[model samples]
Target: MVHITRGLATALLGFAEEAEPESFSTGLGTTPAREFEVDLGCPPETPIFTHFYHPDAGGSVSAVFGMDFSTPAGRTHGRFVSHPQGRLAVAITDDLHATMLVAVPPWGIDELAAFDRRGARQPLEIVEAEPPLETL
Candidate 1:
């Protein structure tokens, strides 16, 4: 099993939060933009996110996060495949156009969702830069 030192885990998580998104696509396996499991079922007010497991990647983990400006709370979820050793809680941060999942300790999963919701309280890292023009 590939065990990352606690320090490494923390560093990685921090890096994810600060990393700039390449593309803003809301799909999986797509580079540039990262996607998460978002409750697409939500309206343009409240958003809910979910967790997913891939059970592949040779034990390495992967995830997808989504974001919607229509909702006050950004929702996200996706599959996370990990090594057979142990799974950890993921930290989801709003990247405005995308989201980033920081691998926390296994126990962090319990509070991961909660932290995600709270993270939404702050203004997103990016917002609609300009408003649409009105027709005369």
Candidate 2:
């Protein structure tokens, strides 16, 4: 499992929202020209294949991101792996479910910034330019 820090999540969000959309080819076809959302209702330690549609990366990629269900919130910390290699910004929806915003290709965890993590908000560092795109 990949370690997804709050800082990483914030950076990805900024890149996804700020960067211009660019299309990339996949094995199946061209990916969507918009950001994609995924709901991972996975239990801890269990491995599964999940699909992510990335606008910049231009295709649907599959990866594994799960947690252990021992505690009430499942795993407070978890990781997500993608084909072109990306980072996941996860919001714990419940004990067994989470909402993920995948920052796919052309994006990576470059740095961390200080922000307020109050209520439902997470802290994210800002980057001036969008990161490089990854290959298939």
Candidate achieving the largest TM-score: 1
26-120: candidate 1 lDDT, tens digit per residue: 21111111121322222333322221211232232223333233222323232122212222322232232333332323323221221132233
Which candidate has the highest lDDT of all? Answer: 2
lDDT of each: 0.25, 0.29
Give residue 12's lDDT in candidate 2 (0 to 100): 44
Clash count list over all predictions: 18, 6
**lDDT of the structure predicted as candidate 1:** 0.25
When superposed on Cα atoms, how far off is each prediction in RMSD? 17.0, 15.9
TM-score, cand. 1: 0.21
lDDT of 1 at 88: 33
Give one digit per residue, the lDDT tens place, for model 2 in 62-127. 122243222223322222222233223322321112222234554455422121222132433222
For the record, the alpha-carbon RMSD of candidate 1 to the native fold, in angstroms, is: 17.0
